[model samples]
Target: MNKSNIAILVLIGILFSSCTMKKETMPPNILFIAVDDLRTELGCYGNTVIKSPNIDQLAHDGVLFSNHFVNVPTCGASRHSLLTGMRPISKDYLRNDITELTLTNKQEQDAPETFIHHLKRNGYHTVGIGKISHSADGYIYGYNEAPSTKQELPNSWDELDFDYGKWKSGWNAFFGYANGENRQSLKRQVKPYEKGVVNDTGYVDGLTTKLAISKLNQLKKSSKPFFLGIGFFRPHLPFNAPKKYWDLYDRDSIPISPNPMIPEGVNLKSLHESGELNGYKLGEEKASLNHPVSEQYARTLRHAYYACVSYIDNQIGHILKELNKLGLDKNTIVVVWGDHGWHLGDQQMWGKHTIFENALKSPLIIKVPNKYKSKSVNSIIETVDIYPGLMELCNIKLPDSLDGKSFVSILEQKNMQTDNVAYSYYRDGISLRTNRYRLTKYYRKEEPTIELYDHNSDPFESKNISNDNKEIVEKLIPILEKGNKEIFY
Candidate 1:
């Protein structure tokens, strides 16, 4: 009687314990990839010229947003707003360089909270591979350190030293005084070398990708969730990539920009007056138009940019492969985004200072495992939304101070509307890109001009329809005024 009773009791206890034990659910890992100065010139974005097979494949596999823009166009300002989930207008970060933009030195230390910090607090191991937040304090931003407990990646540029002065100014060896005056400048200027060249052995994009691959491999064995930020610095200034990439495109095949030269008699007085176009030195219209940049040179530049993009994409593929190999792809959320769009000889402009669609739009791709797959969202989304979107995707509590709303619903539905208008502000101009229209208003007292483009009819934004469509202008004027009144911080 005693043996039978004891055996029955033990069996009953074991069954009850099995039913009550809590099953551990691992939190989804995040693969955050950021590219510097990348425009919507990829194959997925309908640019037939640039070769971005890896990125195009990613878009095909995941959800790609047709219209995505950044808070600001510059690096530091854009990154600051992106990390803090605030607009450049709100943070007063109107320009590059954190020290010059943020007034107080202590303000840098007590800056707005970042999504990375939030992830770290939520038991996720945060590791920033490269160019995450300008790397002010090495420890805070994860620079000059080995990969975390999550993974290990070899540092390609750890031993290399960068000569910023020689790189930017291009003097053989220039020395500056204590007051920041140039003491001596050499006569011969050093030519800028492309990446993968012997001189550019320490390319930032290559180094960053190498490190990221290492981290991805190491994270395979970790039990804790990880947030890996892989930032690629490419297609920016100094246009650097491997020589092979430069040879990918045919010289004559490289198409010239539709509006390569600015029209004659069209007044650029406003741009010149604003001091914004100060150093960009505009030559005579005839000279500028007649000066022949050989097809070879044009092809070379295009090839370099495209090659850098491919390089980044290859690295991304490597990381994604590692995730799949580690059995993490099922539980991981991957987001690939470019900071802002770049101009390739559009409106006679080369860089991204202007508020054109080519300069504003960015590539935004999100893959949320089994939940959100094979979806394409055409809604206009701002970079600010990334902060809240990540929080919602991971089911993490978002900070109340964040100004962005989670557009997680848009990921499911192709035509979901989170906001009626997506806003982008430059120094004195505010651009409101709605579903079908884009309106830009210059806030100059003397010459407050308005430029409007009906994207439905004019996707290329060639004609300024503001003057012609007076009725539509009247309809959108009130909305634009209201948006201008609302602070974007």
Candidate 2:
């Protein structure tokens, strides 16, 4: 063989090796951020009133999903679906507190080998902060606390600097009451607002943000590829935040709900009439109205919620900036999502647990580094899709039992159709949302009552055309049937 031929072969081999190394090194690190009970109420999601600059900026940098619904609206069910990559109905697990659900034979106690466990097993340093599970208390989920192990309590709880008895964090403190039904007990303990103080001064969201920042700094120094899940507990309930945040907005300026005042003679569904407000009841309808909230009071509550969101956004911005400073932004994939939407006075409701869009629709923002930059996807995506989607984004080998399909194709192709309908189920009710239509069937076996709304025509879902268009209903019935078959089977 000639020396020239041998040299040419060696050059080709070097080029191939370089290309392979580049491809292998391209796998980006993931920064999965999950918020509790947040709705699609930001500037990016066409919410002009709410101030979420951090989230809006993140959306501008990457992709903001227009339509992202959770499998279930409640905390436990939604998180279970998101973590496990399966629908709540399919798993037959729809309640909070893994222990109670398991004891009552309602659902399984352990998480079904979630994406986090998968990542951990595959050599990613996984750490969860704040409320990742139904319970804010970590012991409920088998972390840090065990009968055989010594309990190393944080200094904050030991010193009793904060009102541990009243707030979720404080409950393990001096005044902790695990069985208490009234959340107002904690609400009453919070000081209206104070400036420049860390201990017992700010809301839980602020505390969570501070802790998350600390975690980020610690993780940055570590050599391992980390999966940090920072869960923010805010805009959820009690409507508490720093008084300054509440003071930011004028009460009268807060916009009234798009569908304010539930219409007269609107059919009372079993969900509403059941009198369970899905778990947390702000108050009875008559009581809420009789003690009619003044415009000032309404504004105050809305202002607090908005302030909490802004606070969260600010924290997120800080984290993102840190990621950039550490040169991790190039390899980190950031996903900011709300567990479910909250009802800020829509249909006379104030909390999640309803099957309405206001309650079920959550904001899903994904930043896939240099590879997937400045892309917006409008495909129908469920919370269950998050697991597989992350798997594909990180190029991880996903398990075959995953119920979700990766929407990575949709990221590349804007108009990709992963599924014809995004299905969501709550107890007996099932909802199917498509590009142009939303059809919901309330019951099984019996003639399923359907409500059809053309999303393009009526974005607010004001008018139900199910009764008016018999042919459309008939046509959609089979589609709904097919969707349910997949959802249940």
Best by TM-score: 2
My TM-score estimates for the predictions, one after another, are 0.77, 0.78
Residues 1-489, model 1: lDDT tens digits: 799999999999998877555212667888988887788878888888777777787788788888888867766677766776876544256565542234223322333247776777678877766555543211121322322221111111111112222222211111111122221231112112243542222344544556666777887777678888876666654455665666567656777666555433223422222122122223112112334344454455556567667666666777777778877888788889888887665555556756667778888998887775667787778888899998888889887767576778777565488454776767566777888998877676544367788888767676676777888888877777664644332
TM-score of 2: 0.78
Write down the worst ten-residue block by lDDT for model 1: 151-160
Off by over 4 Å in 1: 1-24, 98-112, 135-202, 263-297, 446-448, 485-489
10 residues in a row with least lDDT, candidate 2? 151-160
**TM-score (C-alpha) between model 1 and the true structure:** 0.77
User: Model 2, stretches more than 4 Å misplaced?
Assistant: 1-26, 98-112, 141-201, 263-266, 270-297, 444-448, 483-489
lDDT of 2 by residue, 362-415 (tens): 999998887656667788999989999888887788977776878887887854
What are the lDDT figures for the candidates, one per model? Answer: 0.62, 0.64
| lDDT for position 152 in model 1 | 17
Q: Model 2 clash pairs?
A: 29-331, 164-170, 164-171, 165-175, 171-176
